[model samples]
Target: MTALPLTEAARGATPTSSRVAAVTRLHLARRINVLVVPLIITAVVFVVTIVIQVAIQRATAGGSTAADYAAGARLNPAIAWAQTGYFVALGVSTVASTFPLAASLGTTRRDFALGTTLAHLLTSLYLTAVFTALLGLELLTDHWFGGFYVFDVGLLGAGDPATFAATIAVSSLLCLSIGSVFGAAWLRFGPRGPLAISLATVLVLAVVLLVAVPSFDALTTAFRPWWLVVGAAALIVLSVGGTFAFLRRASVR
Candidate 1:
């Protein structure tokens, strides 16, 4: 088959909006496993945790078989943290793989970055919706599955349902953005760059922890919804902006 001329291929190229959408679609498609498998595992872990907790409660009841073991049951919602790692991997893999491929296919860096950001946003929103719905169902069922507290624990269960969902969504976006920033660092400066950045961040954090240990309680107390939202937005802006800046000069290797 004869290849089309460069000019002809350019003229027949996908429209700008379609190109961006395609990038987003492709990224999402490639990440479906990462997006889904973790959640399923998380749900299984939650159920298992509930079972273990119930068994312990029953054993400790001292021959009282009719004791209400489900009462006062609580389980940490740490399984949700799996979503954080998933997003981080998603960000890194998308940049490591898709960025170069898209660039080679004549897609501009701007469109690629925009599409990636859009994909992250959509993924975060979808996860948030699922989480919120599950939480609502848990509450409606009076903490289903032996009254285990999977979604209702710590700050996640502190506020009203709307506040909880908003917090989750914002935090998810922030996590995705931070992951993308790390991925971009790797893309721009290779493996050494990310290692250096990680070391610097750890050093800075250690210093802060040592110097400000006494004020940690105050900081924790002041972490209200408004402040969290503001901080998450700021981090998202910084991460996305940094990724874009890096990609503008990034070479496909």
Candidate 2:
């Protein structure tokens, strides 16, 4: 196909309001991987957690189950963290595979970036709501779903709606952003791209930790939930910015 001039491409392209949406739709083309898979994982996590909870209860049959469960809560009953690696892999694979296709289909880098962000936001919201709903059910059932704590574990906010939602949203965004940026890096600079980014990140984090060692106690004492939201927000911004920067000059086919 002959290349359209910039003016012609602009004139022929989708409207400003819809271009990002178009890119998002393009991302959603792989709905099974991008959307449905995480849900499947959630289901699996739910059943597995329930089984573990029930087993723990049965094992503690001699004592007060509640008390024993409470004592062993340190093991982190809510194994929802299973979704963490999946979300990250989702981000990486989506960006790495989708960017070229979006570009070839006439999506501007800006639109693709914005659209990816929108897609992640929607996905995060969807997952968070699903978790919140299941959590509500767990609470309503008096934590006796098959005589086990399915979602009211401490790691899952112990039944606090807002905290749980925030945790899920923040975590989803983090994993997606982290994956997207790495994918963008790979596209921009091949395999070494992610390696370089990882080394730089580790170096920076190590430096920060070393510098903050003296104030570790104070930092721990002053910890708050908002801190996570703030940190995740900052990382998301950086990830998006890095993605844009990488793609803006990329000579992808």
The top-ranked prediction according to TM-score is 2
Off by over 4 Å in 2: 1-13, 74-78
- Global lDDT scores for all candidate models: 0.74, 0.79
Report how far residue 137 has shifted in candidate 1, in Å. Answer: 1.1
- The backbone clash count of each candidate, in order, is 0, 0
Q: How close is candidate 2 to the true structure, as a TM-score?
A: 0.90
lDDT over C-alpha atoms for residue 249 of model 2:
76
lDDT score, residue 159, model 2?
A: 69
**Best-fitting candidate, scored by lDDT:** 2
Model 1 alpha-carbon drift over 4 Å, by segment = 1-15, 62-75, 214-223
Model 2, 89-194: lDDT tens digits are: 9988778888887777777788789989898888888889888887788778876545456566677677689888888888888899889999999988888889
RMSD of each: 4.3, 3.1
Tell me the TM-score of each prediction against the true structure: 0.82, 0.90
- The sequence of per-residue lDDT tens digits that candidate 1 reaches over residues 1-253 is 1111224366357566776787788777765454776578668877787787678766776644433443334335565675677777777777767787777666778878988899889888987888888788878887774656777655575425987788788888887788887887888888876787789879988998998788989888876758767867987998899889888877788
